[model samples]
Target: MPVRYLIVDDEEPGRINLRLALADYPDWQLVAECDGNAAARAALARHDVDVIFLDVQMPGETGLVLARELACLCEPPLIVFVTAFSAHAVDAFEVHALDYLLKPLDDTRLAHAVERAAAMLRQRQREAYGAALRDYAVAGAAPYPERIGVRSVGRIEQVVVDEILWMEAAGNYVELHLPARTVLHRITLNRLEALLDPARFLRVHRGAIVRRDQIASLATGGEGSHRLALRCGGVVPVSGSYLAALKAAMAF
Candidate 1:
């Protein structure tokens, strides 16, 4: 059987271009094309694709978010992130994505990714699977809530995980929101999500995660999108990519 592949990108042109490039591979089957994370999730749930060509930046749910979920699947497809952002290469490798392709993707790179996917699919070892995940966990360095250390001015301050209200990404640094005050921490949202307990801190957006108890309300935005109104009077826009999980988390 040919290797089944799924192409996921928010841009119609990118998707079409990838499809056109892949047309040269007689052994590859274009199983599906998803415009965003929601469609990709639905297709993954219903199909038996062997690999995915995923775009990192989208309007709502990021390619990374979908990759995390796919990692939990019984037989997850090989992930080759297709994105314009080269800055996330380290993060992508850390997440154990098969390959990272830049925008205006080249046929040579696509072929290389396909070849890597083939090699990975043929591997018989399961031990290496957990190793990649372990590396990824460390690569995406998220602070452990039970024991989090923050830097306030020139002093190293420690804050318990449970006391956190929410976190926001500010360039290379993160703003840690607490009940009494907000503190600045040097961490990426991707790394932070890996450390925090998912049950306690729900990622409502690409750059924000709120403690479940800190959410004030979920207000509907125009179209099918939603926004999370925090207890601190801050609103976090929920992407359509993550709306399903967010709704399930809130039992809405």
Candidate 2:
């Protein structure tokens, strides 16, 4: 059987370009194309796809968020993140993603990613599975915080993870929030999430992640959407798709 595949990116042109690039790969069937994380999530729940060409940055839920969820499945498809951002490469490999493809969708690169996906599907090593679990545990460590190195003026500074109130993506850099300070780092929010404790730090929006203790309350607005009000009085909008997870986290 042809390797069933799903292409997920918010950009229509990017998706179309990827399809065109994969035209020669007859062994890889283009099973679905999803514009956003919600659509991709729905498709994954219903399909038995072999691989996914995912874009890391999207409007609502990011590819990383979807990837983490997929990792919980019995047989998660091989993930190849198709992203314009290169800063996330380290984090991608940490989560055991099959490969990473830079955007603008190079034909050669796409073909290589597809080939890697094929190899992963065939072998499906238990070591890779164990590595993925180890990555998740290391990434999700909480309560006792670790020191994250950050570059300050002239030199690097070690910041305690627990002091973080929230993080916001600002173009190529991520803004780290704390009780009395806010600093900018060269890393993207996606990369930062992979290093933070998921139980204590929840991504409430596409561009933001908040520490659970820092969240003052969650307010529901029109159309069933929610907004996270932080102890600092900063508010971040939460999409409907992630509302369930947030509500569950806040419960008890």
Off by over 4 Å in 2: 88-97, 126-252
Tens digit of per-residue lDDT, candidate 2, span 1-252: 788889999989998988888888888788899998889879878888877889989987888787777666655676777877755454544333336788676777676667656765666642454345334434443332265545332223446677888889998678888778888865667777876778788887889898888767888788787888888878898887777878887785
Q: After superposition, how far is residue 17 of candidate 1 from its true place, in Å?
A: 0.4
Candidate 1 segments exceeding 4 Å error: 87-97, 125-134, 143-252
Cα miss at 37, model 1 (Å)? 1.0
C-alpha TM-score for every candidate: 0.52, 0.51
Error in Å for residue 6 of model 2: 0.4
lDDT at 99 for candidate 1?
58
How high is the lDDT of residue 207 in model 2?
90
Clashes of 2: 0
